[model samples]
Structures are given as structure tokens and as C-alpha cells.
Target: MPAGLTVALVAGEASGDQLGAGLVRELRRQVPGVRCVGIAGPAMQAAGCEPWWEADELAVMGLFEIVRDLPRLLRLRRALIARLLAARPAVFIGIDAPDFNLGVEKTLRAAGITTVHYVSPSVWAWREGRIRTIRKAVDRMLCVLPFEEAFYARHGVDARFVGHPLADELAPGGDAAAARRELALPPEGPVLAILPGSRRGEIERMGAPYAETIAWLAARLPTLACVLPVARPALLAPLQAALSAAGVDASRCRLVEGQARSALVAADAALVTSGTASLESALLGCPLVVAYRASALSLALVRGLRLIRIRHFALPNLLTPTPVVPEFLQAEVTAARLGPALERLLTDPAARATQQEEFGKLHALLRCDASRRAAEAVAALLPGYRAPNEP
Candidate 1:
């Protein structure tokens, strides 16, 4: 490794922060004293990446939300691009946040710096046409899912399936009793994990329905315990307000800060939002009901334009050949539907076992030591680079 080797990165949310942290650790191991810099979070910062801007600044979601924050985002991108250009690192890696990162990568790549996108966007689903833009922007795409490599291949893009880091971080079927003890939850009752989302917009739209579902379920099972994991400190007050308005029993529900995986481990079942949280619940072997609600205009455009390509929205469902979990979207995300779906998981042994079995298979498929593989892929892009194990 060179004395002044540097790698640039940008991770937009908590999940991406986790991914970025893993990638940074592996890169540091492969090349000692490698300098990592760009937009980062606490996890990535702890892993040794110097942040040019915090990841939270780029956390806006949905079409309307992005529009509202566009001017500020553009300014941030322009400044970041100029700084990165001056640094002239070995390679630039964009962890996730395709909308923001891809543009940054495209500009940097045009200036003769190599660019890599860590997570493949949902081109395999809706917005398949974005492949054209991605082709010009990314030198390589590091995919977490197996099928994504082939999808990019057909479009004449260079891609590699690096597996998912979460699959490697978490084991299949975690110890519920141990996790319950650590979280101070009831040791001998059916526990349910509720994860609305990591973003403010997501909780704003889904919190009411999720709170109502908890209230509905509490009425049925006297011994039912609930654990809700708040992704960020900013979301705590709003989530609490929603639960209070829905008349959910504050005594039975415990709100933990940022230990979502632990909350899922302690839970027998979960009501998870339809993105990374749904995937995390499945990986932890917790039976779950997946639900999502977005802005009215965004939902309308997706539905009216017929932009969605797949029948299933949840990551667990998309990963499997057949959908194993129930999902409620938009208007379908109601207490009436979500409550019953979760109830089945809690009460029916067969239903719980079925989902768990499928989850186990998916977990095995994705546990490919992803961080090392992603590091190797990034290493391949640098001039005169060689793996430590190689001759």
C-alpha cells in the first residue's frame, strides 16, 4: 500500500453507516494507514473515516422531501465534489444513497477518478431505465444481493455480488431470553418488536397506523410485551406522541434507543417497516408483518404511472422466490390488517416455523463475509494494488 493512499465514501443513513463502517474496517486491515474521508456517521467515524459532512444531512426521503431539500443538497454536493477533486483519492466509494451519491460519483468519474457504488439501486424493480444513468456514473457496482450481479451484467455494467454485511453481523435465530434480559424486557412473555423507520418522513406517515396496531394487539393478549426501537433521538418525541394518541399502554411498551436488532432478537415477532428493518427482522429469525406508508403524492405517482415492477415490496419477500411474509402498503397499512398478521405469528406455531425456516435459508445464502469481499473489490480498482494473501 502507498504511504498516502486515500479512499472517499458517502453513506446517507443508519443502515448505510453500518455498511460503510464494515467496509472501512476491512480496507484499513488490507492497507494499513489508509485515509478514508467524506460524508459519514458515528459508526463510520468510529471505524476511522474522517467526515466532511455528517450522514444525517442527506437523510431526506420520498419525492416531496427531496424536492424540499434540493437546493441545500445541491450546494453540499458541489462543495463536496470540489474538495474530493482536490484530494484526488485512489478511488471513491458511495455506500448507498444513490440519488445523491451517484451524481457525486458521476462528476468525480468524469474527472478521471474511479467510482464504485456499494449497494445497487432498485433498478431491478422500478426505474429500470436508471441503468442508463448508472452506466455513465459508476465504474463498478458492489451488490449485496446475489441476483443483482446478473441484473447489472445484462445491462452491460461491471458488478459483483458481495453479499450483505448484516447477514454476517447477525446470527440466525438469536437468543431471545438473553436479549430480553439485556433490554430489561419481560423474560417470560410474547414480545413484539415495532420498527417504524429510520427516517423522519417514514415515521411521520407510518407512526399512527403502527401505534394503532400496538393498541389493538394489547387488547387481546394481556401478557403481550412490546419493544419499539427508535432509530434516532430526533424521532423519539414524535413516536411517543403517536403512541400516546393511539392510547397504547405506556406501561407495556418499552422504547429503546438505536438497538433495533436487539429489540428484534428479544421479540417473538415484529411489525417492521418494508425496507432494511424487514430484512433485519428476517435475518434475526423473528416472524414479522411488513408495512409501509409514503407521501400521498409519491404513492399516487407510483400507482398512477404504474412504475412499480414487482408484486412484493418487502426486502425479505423480494429475496425469496415466493413471498413468505404478509405486507401492507399505503391504504392497506391499517391496524385491522397488521394486527391480525402479527397475531398469527405470535399464536400459530406453524406460521412462525414457516417464516423462520425461510429466513434461515436466506440468512445462509447471504452470510458471505461481505466486508472482506467488498474491500477486495475496491482494492482491485487501485493501480499496482495486490491482496496481502496473494503472491
Candidate 2:
């Protein structure tokens, strides 16, 4: 292994921040005095990464949103490229945010720097043509999901499945009773967890409908307790306003700041927006219904172009041999539709138990020590690299 190695990492969102932080810790352990520099969130900074820019700067989502912010994003990318070229790190790893990172990786790789993309772009799902861009951008691709490795292999790309970091972080067989006790909730009643998403745009799009679904559930099951976990402090006001607008009573619901995992563990079921949270709900063994709604233009463009390839959108369903959870998208994501799915998970013991059984299997499949495996993959790209314990 190289001494005093410098590795550049760019993580564009909260999930990527988490993956980057974990990978940074493992890399530091594997290579003593390793220097990490790039765009980072608080987690990565705490893990000893020097931030050229905050992760939130690159956190814009959706086609319309990206188009609006294109100029600023392009400028940021140019500045980052110049700085990285000057420093010439051993490897550059872009964690998630494929749209932004892939372009940077291509430029850096073209400059003769080894580049790794930490998360595979959804080439299997939409815009399959991105595979060629990915092939040009990365020396190696590190995927968190098991199926992605096979997809990359079929395309003849150098990739490895590091398993999922969330699976490793969460314990198998979570105790709902204990989580409820910690939240000071009754041990006997049904509780539903609502996680619209972590981003502001996500909250704006899905929060109102999710709150309405909660309201519907509350009326249907009088004893129902709803808990919403806010990922960031900024989201609290918007979420509360959305719930209020939906005529949801404050007494029937509790708004907790952070503790998303605890919220999922405590709930009998979850109403989650389709993204990383769906995967988290599954790993926590929380029976859930995944819901998503985008802007009219975005949905039209996606459907018009016929971009999606897979049959299922939810991560749990995608990983399972069969669809284990129900999904509502676009026009189908109505409170009326989502309410029944949540009700079933809350009321039907057989259904919840079956989902839990499937969740356990999925958990086992993804529980490989992900951070260490990812570090080993990144380390392999370095000249004469060896594991810390290796000769």
C-alpha cells in the first residue's frame, strides 16, 4: 500500500454522505495517514475528509431542477476538476449522484487519474445508454445492491457488489417493542412510520399526500399512532404544515426530529417515498408501501421516452424474487390507494409476518461488511496495494 495516500471523494446527498463517511473510516484504517479531500457533508468531514465544497451544493434533484441549476453546477464541476488535477489523488470515488459525478469522473480519468464510482447509476432501470458514459468514466464501479454486480458484468464493466451499508448498520430482527418504549409509545397499538424523503424537493412533492394518507389511516383505525421522522431540521416546518393542511390531528401523530431508524423500528408499517428510505424500511423489517410522485413534466418525459426498464420500483421488491410490497407511482399515488396498503400492513398479521420473513432474507443477503469491502475495492486500484494485514 502507498504511504500517505490521498483519495478524492465526492458525495452529493445525505445517503452518499453516509456511504462516503463509512468508506473514509475503513480507508483510514487500511492505509495509515490517508488524506481524504472532496465535497462532503458533516459525516464525511467528521470522518476526516477535507471538503472543497459542502455536499448540499450538489444535492439538486430532478431534470427540471438540474436544468435550472446547470450553470452553477457546471462551474462547480470545473473548479473541482482543476483542484483535483493539481493535487492528483491516488483515486477519485464518486458516491451516488451519478449525473454530476460521472461527468467529473470522466474528466479526471481522462487526465490519467484512477477513478471509481461508488454507486452504480440506474443503468438497469432508465436511460440504459448511460452505460457507455459509465464505461468511460470509471476504472471500477462499486455497487451496494447484489443484482447490480450481475448487471455490470453482463455489460462487461469492472464492478463489484460491496453489499449495502444500511444492512450492515441496522441489526437483524429489530425489536418494535423496545423502539416503541424508547419513543414513549404504548406497547399495544399500531404505529405507522411516515418518511416522505430527506430532500426539500421530495418533501414538497410527497409530504402532502403522505400526510393525507396518515389522516386516512387515523380515521380508519381510531387507535392508530402515526410517527413521522424528519431527516433534517429544515424539513420539520414543511412536514408539520403538510400534516396540518391535511386535517390530521396533532394528538394522533407525533413529529420527531431525526431518529429515522428508531421510527421505522417502532412502527408496525411505513408509508415511504420511493428511494433509499424504502431500502431502510425493508432492512428494519418494517412492512411498507412505497409511493412516488414527480412533477407533471418529469413524469411525462419519463413515460414519453419509455425510459424505465424494470417492473418494480421499490428496492425491496426489486431485490426480492417476487414483489413483496405494493408501489404507487404518479397518478396511482393517491391517499385513497396508499391508505389501504398501510391499513393491510397494520391490520393483517399474516401479511406483515410474511413481509417480515422476506425482509429477513433480504437483510441476510445484503449484510456483508460493506464498508470494508468497498475499501478493499478502492484499494485494489492503487499500485501494489495490499490490505492492512497483508504482507
The regions of model 1 sitting more than 4 angstroms off are: none
- The sequence of per-residue lDDT tens digits that candidate 2 reaches over residues 189-285 is 8999888888888899898888888888888899999888888899999999998999999888888888888989999899999999999999888
Against the hidden reference, what TM-scores do the models get?
0.97, 0.96
* Error in Å for residue 309 of model 1: 0.7
- Best lDDT goes to which candidate? 1
| Residue pairs in collision within model 2 | none
Q: Model 2 segments beyond 4 Å from truth? A: 388-391
What C-alpha lDDT do the candidate models reach, one value each? Answer: 0.91, 0.90
The C-alpha RMSD in Å for every predicted model, in order, reads 1.4, 1.5
Cα TM-score of candidate 2? 0.96
For model 2, give the 10-residue run with minimal summed lDDT. Answer: 382-391
Residue-level lDDT for 18 in candidate 1: 87
Alpha carbon RMSD to native, model 2: 1.5
